[model samples]
Target: ISYVFIVENTGNVTLTNIQVQDVLPGLMLTGGPIAQLLPGEIDSTTFTATYIITQEDLDTGSVTNSASVSSEAPRGDLNDPSDDIVDTSDDPNDSSNEDPNGDGDPDDPTVTLVNSIYDLEVSKEVDELEPVVGDEVTFTIEVANIGNVTATDIVISEQIPSGYVYVNHIATNGNISYSDITGEWTITQLDPDQVEILQVTVEVLGFGDYLNIAYVQSSVGGNDVNIGNDEDSAEVDPICLTIYNEFSPDGDGVNETFVIDCLERFPDNKLEVYNRWGNMVYSTRGYLNDWSGTTNGRAVVKDSDNLPAGTYYYVLDLGDGSDPRVGWLYINRKN
Candidate 1:
């Protein structure tokens, strides 16, 4: 990567012996040794430096560089008395060349370093795409740092929406803390080019869409340079479908027929019961909440006389173009 530094002369009098120095880590100073600068002069000249990005840099995302400048003004150009060289005994000009502090340089110069650039991106997902109410939903939040400098004290947070409640045992691959008071999950830091995945489990309390939004930001005392990718959200809508895992057709008038709670809402539905070998044992169209555990083709009345007691498979189709409900059903009949 390449960068540039600017040097300007703001004083009233012309400055001499102007010099610029840049001390940057992981960067080699290729050129930019300015020797002089007149008053009101500005060096907008582009300075060239080379830097090879490392795996760590790519993983962490960025590096910082700081540069400094210095110059000498003629004795008459001195505006403030404090600008004059300090002396205790002899003349200031005579002692000017003398080095009491022994630092070797008599000029004190200061320069403001370049500001940092930032880039952050976030993505969120849920483990259960078709979750039901009261089910535990695990939300995964991914924050990626794509900037050019290391971001410090990074904080990522997620606020549990109104239809959810935060659960215990939140998992993450970064520095994190969970707060019940705020119903939030927080990650403390994320380096450039690095990605952090945070898994938080929450219970779905409502039946409608469960939308969760999360945001990522640098809290290292400065704003993120790119706040565009700082926030993301994911949602899951629970459907109205239920299945019964067991039923008895003993004719005792109690739990005698296989039941589906919401299948009646759709009048064009179909139900198919299969034996252990995937053979269609019972099939019905526009089912009226009836399954006597007997094969539809059987000529006997009792379930034991027609189909033996065992486990079976069922497919419920609501004819609504949605996914069909499939699960195991136990046929418990006593002769």
Candidate 2:
């Protein structure tokens, strides 16, 4: 930064050997040392100086420099011969001195304020920790600015794992758009101590451990102060189930009952079967993979011992306080 000092002869006598001195380290004073200045006469030559700002200065928030002017006074006692030196130092207690900014100190010390820092933290969360297949899961992503300055043009990215399809998204303070596996959130500005939340919904196609990740991609500022909290991830494990859609209840002694893989894992489950007319045909608790073409004797068809071949619906509840699983089931007695 460049600095200019304009020294004026405010005293009554003529001053000689006028010079300027700055207390800031590494500051080099250039230009001329005026020879003499009459009363009420400002220096005609320019006395300038320059100093390079460092990272330490920026971190300190402000840089303060104090300057003073010294000169040689005219000889008054020619007979008693005395060396006279006059100096005008920056005195904060001097009320008569000029203080343009009026910070209560009349020294006129230069203070340059440095810009503040930028810090953005991201966190991710999932509504369902263990969801079933074909379930819609919602992920909440939050971005907070913990710095002192306002952040602008922030871009956050979301990475949707495989076996999951993007459904839709909603944001509190930004615009979001996504493809199949990748999504982007663009924010115009976020003030200090402000937070923005974005919720994305996706459908689980298959069963596995799905890990969704979100992070701060970029911003208009230089860089985030703390990068440790720039990214976060949420994990979900869907419960997989293998159901036999079509079953044969013929007297062949094979495939005579409905089978469901991993059903024994949840012994506290309840299975309910419904016909095409939404009528409950069979309902049982603690199913042991046993169910033939016969109903509970309440919805008997043409034959009292067996039902005709047709399509049916079933609802399986794991009794774990989760949503019940619903699907189609087929009964083929002719096979």
TM-score of 1: 0.44
Instruction: State which candidate has the highest TM-score.
Output: 2
Q: Candidate 1: where are CA atoms >4 Å away?
A: 1-115, 132-135, 205-209, 241-335
Q: lDDT of all the models against the reference?
A: 0.65, 0.77
Q: Write the per-residue lDDT of candidate 2 for residues 1-335, one digit (tens) a residue.
A: 78777788877989877768787898888876788889999863568888887655654556778777767768644343235444433544434576655544366556767676878999999999877776899999999988766777888888778758889888784353444444677878877788988888999755333888888888876577899999999988777677887989998988899877557657789999888888778888988788896777354564345767999999999888889999998999784
Candidate 1 lDDT over 23-104, as tens digits, reads 6567776555555667788776645566666645543444544455555547534445444322111122333454445655
Best candidate (score: lDDT)? 2
By summed lDDT, the worst window of 10 consecutive residues in model 2 runs over 77-86
TM-score of each: 0.44, 0.46
**Listing every candidate in turn, what is its Cα RMSD in Å to the true structure after a full C-alpha superposition?**
12.2, 12.3
